[model samples]
Target chain A: MKAWSIEKPGSREVLKQIDVDKPEPQTGELLIKVKAAGINRTDTLTRQNAALKKPYPILGVEVSGVVDSNQSTDSKLNAGTRVCGLVNHGGYGEYVVMRADRAMILPDELSFKEGAAIPEVFLTAYQTIYWLGELKNEEKILIHAAGSGVGTAAIQLAKQLSQATIFATAGKPEKQEMARKLGASVTINYKEESFDERINDVTKGTGVDVILDFVGASYWPMNLASCAADARWVLIGMLGGSEVERVSLSELMRKRIALKGTLLTPRSDEYKASLSREFMQIAMPLFKEKKLQPIIHTVLPFEKLPEAHRIMENDENIGKIIIKMNQ
Target chain B: MKAWSIEKPGSREVLKQIDVDKPEPQTGELLIKVKAAGINRTDTLTRQNAALKKPYPILGVEVSGVVDSNQSTDSKLNAGTRVCGLVNHGGYGEYVVMRADRAMILPDELSFKEGAAIPEVFLTAYQTIYWLGELKNEEKILIHAAGSGVGTAAIQLAKQLSQATIFATAGKPEKQEMARKLGASVTINYKEESFDERINDVTKGTGVDVILDFVGASYWPMNLASCAADARWVLIGMLGGSEVERVSLSELMRKRIALKGTLLTPRSDEYKASLSREFMQIAMPLFKEKKLQPIIHTVLPFEKLPEAHRIMENDENIGKIIIKMNQ
Candidate 1:
């Protein structure tokens, strides 16, 4: 089996393709023949020797594949059942091993590329909006970087579960329309005008009930300001920076907002299981109903992994970039 | 009528007893002859020239008094009714005007000084524990500055409402005992013990569900480390300082914690009204049943305003320090 392993993490060059023995499924696990995998900023960070307590990691967090083998004799899944999940460590391999609970039955209507795109972003957005944000149809959410994979999914999920008002942000005018098309009630081009100004103007200074932020610590202040009284600010990523500069607690206190930070990879298996159960219950139905669609920006060959990483790093792509696993 | 007023913002010595026209009740308002006013950190901040936007620069926030006059014809309250409530712009005078909606009937068992002690602290504690903390009977909450007025109230309230585990932090051993007597299962001498060491040892590293932090930004990291997987960090004051150092959001993400900073003073009339209403509904019965009692540390003469301010600034008193009107 060929896997992309990080050898002495530094940059994209550190991602090395080497032949390795195919991993076998442990008890309560599945051996999946990887069909596709998605690239994320987390991969970049883990590759750059940042925010890793564990090292020599595989680079993919989301993957689409077929069940090649099951470890548990009593496993319910069939051998060829289509699946998508966080492949225990990550996806960048010809065959990835995952906990049986981590695997979700990929919707029949969706493609392998779309299935690969679904797991990471949707789970993050779901955890942010429902678990922490405590969102309802009566509420409104501000999705920052609405052109991104998580942002795109968040827009649709908010509309699906809550059918609530959504405010999204994009860096370019073209991206703003794309976000709007994805289900944003209001879209603001952060390049031309401040999203905060637009938020205040649109919401009549009431602010949004929830803010799903991926821009990281730099957007901390604006995210706080953009929240309504008793708002929830869920941080899924810190692309811009890590430290929030001069955090005004006075503002957070006045609004009674919750500033929550999250990392999916490091979370306990129990937590991931709970998230998967949610995906199985809520998102699966929505997918079957054709109410939700995975936003795949590009589907490149597995060998073009470096290009995929560069595209995500450049922040030029609006949705998930999938790499087909050459089995 | 005579009242303690600060013509210009400066020190405690600048506080003066001056003759002024008594405030009259407006529509839906009550003119109360203040019997006792709780001396709080808000009064201290106002004295230190904390920029206030209110039209009238009155130094008080919570007062217990006899109704001197009433303008709300339909209000259940009448002249001479004993009540306690949140004050409007002006409260540190012979007669202070307040909305009838913001007032609550004082329990017959409680004295004016005790009644005055209850409002500010109870409001802070109740909002922090129930509304923001989302505390459950089985869960534990960590209260910082546990000897302070709000901390005292939170301990009693959490004890009264449900059988929740409480970890309290106070500066002195004596304060720890007092907090323990008030129902804190464990009291850490914050001045001595590393709360991080004790908290980790106690929860077996699971941490607390909610953190009531009024110590300001200095306690930020401690609060984060002390919190559970889904922890809620509510900030009410900055006694230690507002600038928090080393906010590692990675910890927040890994734990899925909600770090929120809050202040009680700047809330809109609606929020204050809601607070008053909820307090009345949930806490009134507890007060009537004698399950709740206000902890008054000292009762100083209104003329001794400077001394009261000094006591508060030095953190000399336990619970609340109330200023008697007609001493």
Candidate 2:
């Protein structure tokens, strides 16, 4: 099988197309023929990490494909069944092994490219907003990086499922407009205006009940200033920066804030399986009914995998970027 | 009626004994004839707060006494029924008002001083460890300020209810010994040794599952270092300064830590009532069985309330400091 593997960790320059043995299905696993793979920031981080050895695992972490073989006889994920879900690794290849329970059946109405975009962002948004953030109906949520994959998914999920009032922040006009179109009641150009001031004005100084913070250190003070009493803050990404200086713990105590930091990739297999199952049960029907849609920015061919990584690294894409594998 | 009220927000000199009118109970409320009152750090903080106007609210927030009057006809509480509870204010007086639903029936085995020690510290500990920290059986927990009121209460509750592995940190030898006696598996003298290093050595780098932090800024880095993945850290106090410099959000994300800051005093009446009912139901039996007991350091006469505040301000007391009102 043809796969994109890093010879040594550095940049896109280290990426090389090489021949690798096809993955085999273990017990309770399914061998899938990759149709489409989604690109994420985690891939770039893995590429830049010096600790990863040569022949580094394939880049992507999510895929949409057809089950070529299934070891579990009782499961519905038999040969030729279309599915899409997160993987431990090795998604940037012709074939990959997936745990049977983690796979979400791809609906007939959606294409493989769309399916590839659904798992990582939607599942992350679901886990962060509902499971961790505990967002409720009639509550308010402030989602930063509104143009990013998880940001877009969170806005949609918070809007459709919880009927929450959504406040979105983006650096660009196009991104802010897109966020507004996707059920955001208010959108702010973070580069042009101070979001905390805007939040204070809009909320009448009470602030939002929940915040999905992707920009960490750079936004800490603003996030702190924009939280209501007993607010839930879930940090999913630190895109702006990571080092925060002179933080006052008393402010958090006074407001009674709950701040949680998480990454979906490092979770255990059992946790992923459970989250995937719950997400599929609740979201699949919406996907089939066209009430929820996966936002895709571009679909690059298999040979243009490096280009896809570059697009994501530069933050030029509005939503998910996909790498389509030729049959 | 004799009452102790702060003339202004200052030191012990500001606290003066003055005659005030007896409090009256409203609907679903009880008029408590105060027998004992507990002193807390919140009382000292209120004394130091410069924003408070002249003739500030009475010092105490928790008391144990007999019900002088009960307005609720259907409730079990009647005149002369022994009770202890948290009050909104005016606890440092001959008479105070308590919500009928928030009062706990005093067991015959405990004295008025012991009952007074139970409300503030025990409720804070239970809410922090169980409600917020979510400590489970077999999980490891690190409790800071091991000799303090809430610290002692938390150690006993975690040990008795969840059977959790308890790690306690305190500045004084006497405090450490008291923590050990209360069922802490490991007690570290924080003044003598670095707690994070000691914790690293003991847990073999896995760190604790939950942490009860009262030191705030001074312990932020150490708390971050000592947390295991998915650890729940509840911050209830900031005794050792509140400003922290140079915090890394990436570290929190890597560990997936959940940090919550709360103060029980600011909670709504409904929330307090619910928590009080739940705590009474689960813990009252243990109190009756002699399995749970409140720790008291000193009991000063009501007229010497200023001395009690001084003792707490100096951090000289081990457990709760009580003010006993003569019959």
Candidate 3:
């Protein structure tokens, strides 16, 4: 089995392709033959040994694969069944073991590349927007990083499921246009104008009811200023920066805001399993119906994994960048 | 009618007794002849025109009284019916009007002072601990300002309702003892030792599941250090200060903590009515059984309302400070 592994933590140059023995399925696990895998910002972080606490070896967190061996109680998931799931790690390998409960059956209508793109971003978007953010029907939502994988997924889901009026902020014009096409009622190029002021103006002073904040410190002041009373702010990523100077708790209190911080990779297996079940039950049909499409920026051959990382590092991709693992 | 009102925003000297016309009940409202009133920190803030948005004439928020007039649709609340409720304002007067839906029938076992004490602090505590915090049975909770009115009320409610393991932080020895007596499993004299270190040591580094924070800026670091993964921190007050010099969003994400800020005063009439209804259903029976007790530090006459404000300002009292209106 060929897999990408890091001997030591550093730049993308540290990622090494090597032959390794295939992993065995443990109890309540399935041995998956990787067909396609998704690249995420967390992969870069894991390569640097920043967040992923596991011993360095494989990098990917989400994959579309075929069940090679099943050791779980669920009879529906048989060997050779097509599936995609969120893994603890090792998705960049030929053979990766995933918890049986976390695996979602990939619909026949979607390709492996599209299936690979759905788990990480879609589940994260689901978790942040619905579970943590508690977005209600006809509410207003402000989604930052509107071009990112999770951002695109969130816009579509909020549009299809909640009927929420979407406000999006993206740096690139292409990203802004994509966000608008997906669902955003108002799109702001954050580089050109302040999103808070624009959103405030559009809303006629009352800010959005929910905010999906990916840019943390850089957007904190605006996020604070852009919340309606009893707004929910879910922090899924901090791409711009991490630390904010002079944070005021009084403003949060006055608006009665709920700020929740979350990361999909760090969540427990049980949580992932539960989230997968709920998401598949609700969102899989939408994918099958082509109502919710997986937005892919590019799909690269497995050998071009380094290029995929480079593209993401440079923030050139509008949505998910997938790696066809078997190619 | 004689009432305590503030002409200008200032110290306790500004709280002056004046003659005012008795208020009449509007639609869905009841005019009550006040028997007793509860003093809170918000009352002091109202004296200084801090949080309350209403005009600066009255100085109280919760009272227990007999119904003088009813323009409300509720058939049970007739004239002279004993009732207690949260008011938008005007609880310090000889007569006050409150939304009928917000009023609760006083249990025969409780006095007017006891009823007065139940509305504001108990409701706020309930909202913070159970509603926002989502504390489950046997989970550990850390309650700050353990001797303050809401703190004492929360200690009692969490004890009787969830059977939670309570850790409390207080400045004075008497407050600590009162917290213990109410139901706190452990009490920390916050003035003497670092609460975060003690809590971390006790939980074996996992920290508490939920925290009720009243001291804001001063407790930010300690509160961050004292949370378990997926912990809920509800900020209901800012007794210490409101600004933090440096805040790390990454740290909050790593812990997956939910920080919510709330003030019961500014919530809408419908929200107050709903909260009052739910609280009465769940907690009133326990009060009738004497399983829940309102801890009162002193009962001062209406003329001595200024002294009550001074005592609260100086942080001298233990539980709720009640003003007996018709003494």
Q: What is candidate 3's TM-score against the reference? A: 0.96
- Show the lowest summed lDDT stretch of 10 residues, model 1 chain B: B49-58
Note the Cα lDDT for every prediction shown.
0.83, 0.92, 0.92
- Indicate the docking level reached by candidate 3: high
Candidate 3: the clashing residue pairs are none
DockQ of each: 0.47, 0.89, 0.89
Candidate achieving higher lDDT, 1 or 3: 3
DockQ of 3: 0.89
Q: lDDT per residue, candidate 2, B271-316, as tens digits?
A: 8888888899998779888778898999999988988998988888
**Residue runs of model 3 more than 4 Å from their true location after superposition:** A50-55, B50-56
**Residue B288 lDDT in candidate 2:** 84
lDDT of 3 at B116: 91
Lowest summed lDDT window (length 10), candidate 3 chain A: A48-57
CAPRI tier for the interface of model 1: acceptable
True contacts kept of 3: 0.93
lDDT, candidate 3, B1-327, per-residue tens: 999987678788888888978887889899999999999887887688655443566878999999989898888999979999999889999999999999999988999999998999999999998889999999999999999999999999999999998999998898999999999999999889999999999999999999999999989999999999999999988888999989999999999999999999999999999999999899999999999999899999999998998889888988889999864
User: Model 3 residue A27 lDDT?
Assistant: 95
